[model samples]
Target: MQPADGINLHSPPPKLKFEKLSAYKKRKLSHSTVNDTSPPTYQISSRAEESDNSSVVEPDKNLMAEYVDFVKVKPTKKEEVLRILNKKDVTSPKFFQLDSITREDMSHWGLNPGIIAQLRDNIKKFEKHLTPQ
Candidate 1:
């Protein structure tokens, strides 16, 4: 009796196999069992033919510069601050209080206005932590 799908599953399926390119070509070229009218013919051509006259296009430097100019570089302000802060000899709130690093300097280094107060507080805390009780 057939299943509900009404499909016949009586015989085992054919086993899958593969042959080398040379063997396959020989088998196809000679007829053994395949009863097809004509065997498929493949045309292989080389792409390095000198008859090809297509020239490689060079990119415009000016056009590339226009696009590249829009890329924003990462600011080294945080690194500068960390370098100063990590200095063993320069661990004082007075250093921050000195006019060496001004609001203009912060702005030039791409630091926000709010970072000034935060830096001051961090410096104070760091100073307190470093000093004895």
Candidate 2:
């Protein structure tokens, strides 16, 4: 094709893009077969647990202070006591102690507030169970 009358307006062709596939993908394409060997499961060693291996030294106070600071238990109080009671479904007359000492769900949670902590622990266990071995 002839160039423009007073300007060279020809543009180069666009570059082609080629993405590389991983080795796992290539193997999948060659064969669709899979081995039958199962994965491992985590198990606590009862023998070790029973042993009297208490040689490890106790942690120093400075180290303990650092750890405590790292895991500081700081909970900002925001929600009212009634809101918390409403969430845990603890509306029964038996739940309230002296009637005036109601606690907030925000500061803590359900009943002794420790139930919320247990709830968090149970959730962690559930997540561990869900993981692939």
Candidate 3:
């Protein structure tokens, strides 16, 4: 009979079985998988003949520098504070102080003002928990 939800409940649940792979099958699977550590090979055609060649493309230095600059200026006070608080040995008061200092540093490090405001709000929330009982 169908339930109130109008769904069939008479069917049995599916059964799951786990099996071990044979050594030969495992070796075959490993051979089929591509190794990511090595650079990929490509077919390059010169004149009328095509040859398989592996080439490593190096990233432009200017592009890498731009990425590094972006990362350096990103606001990370919240993560830093949480990391400090997660340590088991640190006391609540010390954690709060460290969080405040880190927050100030992040503000001065060219982080967006909105992010600093959010970090300040987070600090207030954590302050409530860290206060003496």
Candidate 4:
């Protein structure tokens, strides 16, 4: 509703414009090094060098492709693989998922330190044999 003076009380006040401050001269050199010929010790160059080969090296695509199937397999699928490994009879050669199998699982499966060491040695030997010459 309008006031007795005919002024709209609901209307907001008009916006005010402000003038910006004058720009100042930027300092090219520090007060201490104004006449010095030596380069500034603390100053870092913004320019990138063409010879700067420093970068994050990505994994080789072909090498990564070799293990892509292993990476894609789910945790449940990996456990199923462990279960299949567990089901193998004592007479058959057994394989363990070293990454997935914990110390508790090894102890539960009746593996001692000597057997674990043998298993690691065997794995290394197998890796050496399977790797390309």
TM-score for every candidate vs. truth? Answer: 0.28, 0.19, 0.20, 0.26
- Model 2: CA > 4 A from native: 1-19, 26-113, 124-133
Candidate 1 per-residue lDDT, tens place, 41-113, comes to: 4432432122122233234434222221222212444444444344423333334444555666655555455
Which structure among the candidates has the greatest TM-score? 1
Question: What is candidate 3's lDDT per residue for 1-133, written digit by digit as tens?
Answer: 3444433456543443446999998887677665554554444444112212323223343432232232342444545533433333222222222423465565555545565454434433443544588
10 residues in a row with least lDDT, candidate 3: 47-56
Q: Write the per-residue lDDT of candidate 4 for residues 1-133, one digit (tens) a residue.
A: 3444433545543443444544432244454467787655542243211212223334333322223222343444444434433453221111232334554565566555444444433433443544699
The TM-score that candidate 3 achieves is 0.20
Best by lDDT: 1
lDDT of each: 0.43, 0.37, 0.41, 0.39
Q: Write the per-residue lDDT of candidate 2 for residues 1-100, one digit (tens) a residue.
A: 5644544435433443556889998787445434434332233344322223332334332432222222232333223333454565543222232223
lDDT of 1 at 26: 81
- TM-score attained by model 1: 0.28
Query: Residue 82 deviation, candidate 4, in Å?
Result: 13
Q: Provide the RMSD of all predictions against the true structure, rounded to 1 decimal.
A: 28.6, 22.3, 21.6, 21.8
Output the worst ten-in-a-row residue range by lDDT, candidate 2. 64-73
Q: Residue 125, candidate 3: how far off, in angstroms?
A: 1.6
Q: Clashing residue pairs, candidate 3? A: none
**Between 1 and 3, whose lDDT is larger?**
1
Residue 53 of model 1, lDDT score: 24
After superposing candidate 1 on the true structure, give the runs of residues whose Cα lies further than 4 Å from its correct spot: 1-94
